[model samples]
Target: MGGERVGRGRGTPLRAVAYAAGGVVLLAGCASMPDSGDLRGVESTPRQDTQVRVFAMPPSEDASSAQIVQGFLEALTSDDPDYKTARQYLTPEAAKTWRPELSTTVLSDVPDAQPDRPDQDDTGSLTYTLTGTKVATVDAQQAYAPASGAYNKLVHLTKRTKSGEWRIDEVPQGVVMGKSDFQRNYMSVDKYYFASNTPGAGEGFLPTAVADPVYVRSHVDPTTRMVRSLIGGPTNWLKPAVRSSFPPGTALREDTGALTPDDRGRLTVPLNDEAAEVGTARCEEMAAQLLLTLRTLSPAVEEAELRTGDRQLCTLSQKGADDVAGRGALHRPGYLYFVDDEHRLVRIAAGGSDSQPDPVPGALGEGEKALRSVAVARDERTAAGVSLDGGSLYVGSLAPGGALGEPVLRSRGKTEEDRLTAPSWDAQGGLWVADRDPGEPGLYLLAEGAEEPLRVRTPDLDGRVRAVRVAADGVRIALVVEKGDRRSLLVGRIDRSPADGGTDEGQAVTVVGLRSATPELEQVTAMSWAGDSRLVVVGREQGGVEQMRYVAVDGSTPDVPPPAALTGVKAVTASEDERAPLVAYSVDGIVRLPSGAQWQKVTEGTAPVYPG
Candidate 1:
């Protein structure tokens, strides 16, 4: 949308283009056809109807200042690499200095450009003010973050005395576009890196892959760009918790071009000299990271080979990579554990069709103490449960004849609603829970599920935490915080340190840098980590009906469709392995949603859970 124009000037009337089912059709003014021309049949090659590419039209000669601003904004949404066409609308100096890659500012809708009065001093110069409601931003590192408030910027244009052509002389640092255009031009991909400083995660133990999600151009050579981003190292937000196996300064070989998997689904990556000196073990780890990150883009990529110059550094197959780093996509929980009607922990085969429910082999399954909620360790060797009163937290072995020990942690909250929330286990065997006491609300963690509970500091928290779920990487935690009747979902980074001599000398942990993951949801009843950087949230928008959807940690909705609708969902659980079926406690009782099917009611139960 543009502001009122003073005059049409010498520019030609703007022509409208309409998108049709087959291709784009340009609507032009009436023109006379030449009857004297030779009538020859034109031959053309038929292209696939599904393949469509949209290109921005270049600026017409003698264009007005308003048309120049509009054309440049449209060009930013095109698929052109390096935005070559967009620069044509800018002055020579501005074109040379403009950096569209610096960052992308997303708006709620197309920006409104309003022209200001002509300059009294310089008649040839004019400025247009661009304003919109901000949505989010993608930084140079490609990391996405939710942004709010107003977006106001100015674009200055000048008319050339020689050609009388108008071009933008001053523009914003990065391109700005509406949310729809952003979804069409960019896509999200996760870059995998090995977890850093995780306790007991050392040599001979499988390194955990931490996901750092970023956006890349959809039509560009995305595979190559993704690889380069991975080699460039994790984003700054996640850099402290993860480490790249590639040596510093390692990059794609200068000669290498677009990357694609061969017929055998093997992708060979050529790196610079920085990676040539790595040993066989470290090289394999590097290859593993590449395979994991690429597989997210192309499931066909089954193997990856790392090369430097003419020599092969190392080659790793999908299975070999899984051996080096844990296989997140292929892992399935052993069972779908839930609280049965009798208030005992019971389970059914995770992948079995006819398996009947059976109580677990631990003391919690004996029904000695009625359970309220439960969390199983990643290894499925240990279990933690809150009592029916929700005041006591118990940890027990899942092995047969395992006895239930004294409550490892207890809450002093007086009422059930003010007691401990459901517990969550991280990959490092750490248990996380939040106390909802009105007077002394806090978040606590049990290192290795045996040490004294550590109160994790929430320096920036604004409300009482209602629930807590730690990601598998153990470096991120999600909390449902309630200030009043309204509840919001927030994800924070976990910082850990070994305590020195002090009054309470133990491992000190703090949850910092809290950011809203569901700012649109007025209330979040339940949520679960469904993937590395995705969560299945059951929440409703402001004044809307309840629904379920998958939201990324950055607060943007994923491309995947939402789960099948169900009524009165009380609790939800999903395994880090996305292939595992979704289990939830709804009005119909415990139900499971198999892939591509409707929800089917399971045995009467509540608080279903999968290994965290």
Candidate 2:
């Protein structure tokens, strides 16, 4: 197995992971690229959730300069529309000039309760310091990026002569808020985009939806803002990688009108004259994008229509939308493979009854050698096996009578803890695995038919990469790196650079976009890609017990809990299905779940995996 030792009943199993205090801190900045298509008839409006409340009011006027600065910081957490109350803390001119939408620095710690007095009073204008240990930031462009260290912020206030009140004159373009209040006032919403390589990708692999995290009003019409944000291009960080399908210069036809869903959950959106130029195929693509993006909103969208100045563009069905983005590509594994007590490969049909697990006709499958865990390719045409001792990785066809190839990827670790992680496969049939050799840690990638594995680099990941899972989109990676006795769950964007002279691009990852995806979880031990943007992880809090939950790449947790608890769990895995069945290797043995449906034991096993 990938761990130091396989778990046995009541034995000292492998160590677990921990998480950040409180729930995961999902910072603001979620929005989809605006672009929707023609409905056969008129495009529908969006649904507005009326229950969300407006933001809290700012400190009363005539407050002290420092108090006004403090009140402005607090108002940043409110869900007010247009941030009018937050603006009240600013001088009217500054209010007109200040752009809070520039970016939001989400502090992992609390802001200073009292601002540091100004270094020098500049006549009527005074400056105060508000700094904290920064966690992450969402910019005006809606780009989310992680930032470390203490943020040095200064809010400059001016004494207003008219009301004898002090108001902020100049401050950072973005807003700043403490983590706890951020949770209370903010919510996470996904903006839909097609994968860069999918059929809907007019160019390369494009994300159909961009999940945007924002401080949505708790009781007002969040739908309008979500749609507006969608029409806006993806946040700046993801812009280089993904493109929006919305027409050039596209915009809502109405400036002040809100888009609301009808009783049947159908939305009609009115676009300006610019969107009137798309063809039928383009219109369908756009509508599909809207269907997926709007589905995350309250009252949800079942179907939708598009309109240009009341002139019907076209309509799209839910199924059509799903098909366009290939969202229905989820397929359960044909057979669940595991290693048995005798060090042989075994399997259980995904839909079979409680029958004794069976072995196959290959070398490893027929008990040729002791194996630790297994990885099946997405095509299910081939598989990879790790040596029971964790020193080697072998690849072979999954068919009966298939001969397991020589070790395709080998490890050079001095101890069991430094062996290779469970191998993962990307969409392009590339094998990705990492060596946990603490003294010489490295990541390797092997494409089909390659003679040897090529080493890939992790720029800022200084610790041991315990686990690695590539997303179905083939652009992002979910990794667990253990460092300084702590583990973190992070998301890295893959950069495929052109190799020397015109060869395929060399695959490398940058530390810049590698954001801390699971801040709530401190020591993440095991992780698997649950969907394109979410991961089902097993982790614990610092000095706390282990727990399993589904968290987004943006540090947002699922609305519901994960499957039942399995103490002494050594490894857990799931298929690409967002709600797919989970297979775990507990101290008891190999178990599969649908929850409460008895964990049908297959055989004695340590590691298990499904096609990504």
Candidate 3:
């Protein structure tokens, strides 16, 4: 997070005291100067038909003592290059008081210095002057001056020369002065990539557009950039830019504890009975699962394969050893869990850190176990009696230190028709899968001892089910579909009676307006019970904005409103008790909350929630 000051800025002079006094008079009602209406002239005055008025001139008519003083101060403090011509407007003592060093300092730093040339309508020389000496005050050095009041001069300035060209000449004493106190400091660009600010998927940059007014495109990679937060927009700069800085809040750092994996190269933990048990441990578990899964599935995880893109655009191979920055009092963690042969979740792993580090951190505890257990396997034949969860194991074959394993996909069928597009399980032991073949959309239900899987056909829904879940009654099924611009939450009933063929399809209901704004919600990646009656749908919005939303099982419109003005929502899932669900966005950190809890995270990570 490095930042440099903009070279171009408006000028403010030190001797504008007389102008300040005029402003004070206007404030007190003693004098009425320009209001918004008068300021409008400032714009129009530059566009008049007459010979272009290069600079403004003082009024021709006699002005009050205050006005005269304002004219004097403005002339001396003017940024215009012809300012030296104002010498004639000052009194003898005032001319001597006009310092050259001040003028040089003010004009030297300007990006481009071209003063306005005098115009035909310029006012003539000075017509008034004032002088005073020995006035006690504070000087520019911030030190107090003695009781003696030093002599000062005020010059009445105008744009014109002689012969009605227009001008007022003569400096007056009793000058008032004002100056600005803006300063600059060092801002490192590295900070923007590592600090934690807002969570979820959002797009902003280090030094951002304003601070680093140079870059044309500033996109960051969610996998590695590790940006924590954003700050200093037009409205807010005085506040801390990222969540990790200074007086940290609980909302950001609550679940940031460390966890290590157990023996058997597995992160085993008991599943809680309550439906809404979303604890820090659960979150850590989920995060580990996703990262480990990604590591095993993607060929690019190797030290030499981590490039900017797929198929070799700009190779970003990983280099060097692995280590974790010190675990902090406030660090949010990510993990994942799976079932072992004994029907217990035995493995856990740490999710990739969201906050960028010069040298990234290593996985803690079950982190290695999760990674080592990840493997990709393929079975040649298919059968209807197969359970998708059968081959999936919670523990790895080797110890926790072993390398990751690839994913394994299992299905039951004679041919490719037996392929499953959408697969989900209900608490009632029913598994549902969907397909989008040309003949008809296929929906299959597999239960214990059912030789021929219950099959349902819905040609209307060729490729709808990215996510499927069994309803509470075990008699109903829910299918989440993604179509053109709209993604719907669809519900149907499980029918045992064979229909046109040997399959049974659930009735369909439309959940519209789910993807009203882009990016659209194209895929339903995860969905869980928000409560006994409510459901939360976590999916990818069109253009890759991850989001979480809710709907009711009673066929009512979803009440779970999207996060207010939130941008990145990577993944969403429900807790055991169906209370709040955690959402992982593209932002550097993960945010946890119920349907109503706002985004909260301490440090940043890709996946921060898991169910065990």
Candidate 4:
């Protein structure tokens, strides 16, 4: 748990003052206030809720070693910007070296401090062992990952010879707290990045923004913190799949502090010299990333201006930012489509769940061929459907006079359950599907829906892929895999490069680095990409009831509460647009759950879906 030290400048001591006007007595720490100089306004986002503030109390006189350890633990959970009060429990030497920002060890519950016998020769000193069940960890990068096993650490305290007071001399490098405290003190924010090695604007594909979510301290200067994290780059897991627009070593100008939007909803960011010379196009892209990331924190921020020293690099409004990169949230699907009771592809207005659904304009919607499942392209111009028997997949335009093309791909499995899973369309106009055929099980991809379906390599897969959904960024894919009798959700990175010793036509396509996104769930029935880096999943824990929850791509649960519960959820679908209603097919037929509302029946339909 050793960590590098971060410098904290010493300031003046506390003082007592009396105000003549109000007869108010104040005992304030001079170190907490800025020194007399040119005053600058530091704006901040208002607290979202009226959460009670808890301040850590300094150790009392003659406190025992155990008391010191307990107080320090409590202080770690307080909102003490720099853990100043926690240092009061440590010896001056220890206080100078401890680094609470290195990482956060989250336990299942508050740790138990057990006293340990002192050295026989050094009876004046005492030690306490902290023990708990480790639940997860947030690294220095503020990335959260699920962890398991016992947490054991030692806190060594020494008695000051002159005062005979117990002070901790040695402790773990980083802070430790329970899961609840971690949730209370931190929040998840998705910083934007562009997908790497993808088609560009000239190729008819807009560079898509991929979300890289990381946890940051809540109630702190989160806007500035998030901007810094964005400039720092994506997390380790997503680094290979995405690239930041900021140049290497780019960072916020050291003098700029606590970024907040002005009265007109404009945020100006001052960057280091590394970004000063970037071209207008690249600078605008960088501003676009900043605008999208900060909009999640402050919706009032309508525009962003980037500066280096006194020179303005670029200024981008919200609409300009949208044109620079395709943020999935900006492209809301117009309708929620599903396989109706008539087994035809029909759609209802996305906003009006109660509105009547009409068959889509195409051969599949004409009922010439019954469909089992379907996926519409992000553009809503073309659609792919799996036949009722699940043996064939057909692609056709969504226009009135468009004809259904012949089966683009077919599976020869013995039963419907062993045939093709639901199809998914990526942002690059590519199509994805998985075959559950035991004899020839595989994941397949069709580039632009015209080329022959290529077999995607899943070298890390442990079981048969039961379902598949490609994210809007096209850099990642979600999979429901079955092994033995259990099913689990896994997210994998998609890599497309030319195959070794082969031409461009034989590109090497693989879904690699598969990691469990829902390790707690014993079975996953269905899932859908609900947001930038989040998935709405339907699953049940071992020996537990079915439930729906949002899981981030990093394999950590988001801070949001689970959606309203529904029973027997067979299929679930959500739009990348967070404002869109959540649609699902359960025992009660097709149902929709609007934001802040309970599930309501939409129609007697199955295989409900939103444009991928």
Per-residue lDDT of model 4, residues 1-612, tens digit only: 111011111323212121222322111221222323221111111222424344456777756554566567766766677888889989999999999988999888766665566223146677677778898888988888888899999888888999987788999999988777677678889889989855442345567899888888875677888999999998888888788879998999989888989999999999999998899988998999998888778798999999999999989998898898987777899889999878889999996846578999978799878999999999998899999999999998898988987899999999999999999998878999999999999999998876799999999999999999999888899999999999999999888777774666567788988988898899999999999989999999999999999999878897787899999999999998998989999999999998899999988889998988
Q: Write the per-residue lDDT of candidate 3 for residues 357-475, one digit (tens) a residue.
A: 22111222223322211211101011111123232212122233433243233334344433444344433334455543434445565442122455655444534454455433233
Q: How many backbone clashes does candidate 1 have?
A: 0
Tell me the whole-model lDDT of each prediction, alpha carbons only: 0.82, 0.65, 0.30, 0.82
Question: Per-residue lDDT of 293-376 in model 1, one digit per residue for the tens?
Answer: 887687888899999999999999988888888744456788999998889999998856743689988898999789999999
The model with the greater TM-score, 1 or 3, is 1
Ranked by TM-score, top first: 1, 4, 2, 3
For candidate 3, the 10 contiguous residues with the lowest summed lDDT are 208-217
Could you give candidate 2's per-residue lDDT for residues 475-522 as a string of tens digits? Answer: 677888887888999887665544553565453433236677777577
Candidate 1 weakest lDDT stretch, 10 residues: 26-35
TM-score of 3: 0.28
Error of 3 at 329 (Å): 34
TM-score per prediction, in order, is: 0.91, 0.78, 0.28, 0.88
lDDT, ranked from best to worst: 1, 4, 2, 3
Q: lDDT of model 3 at residue 465?
A: 54
lDDT of 2: 0.65
Regarding lDDT, does 1 or 3 come out ahead? 1
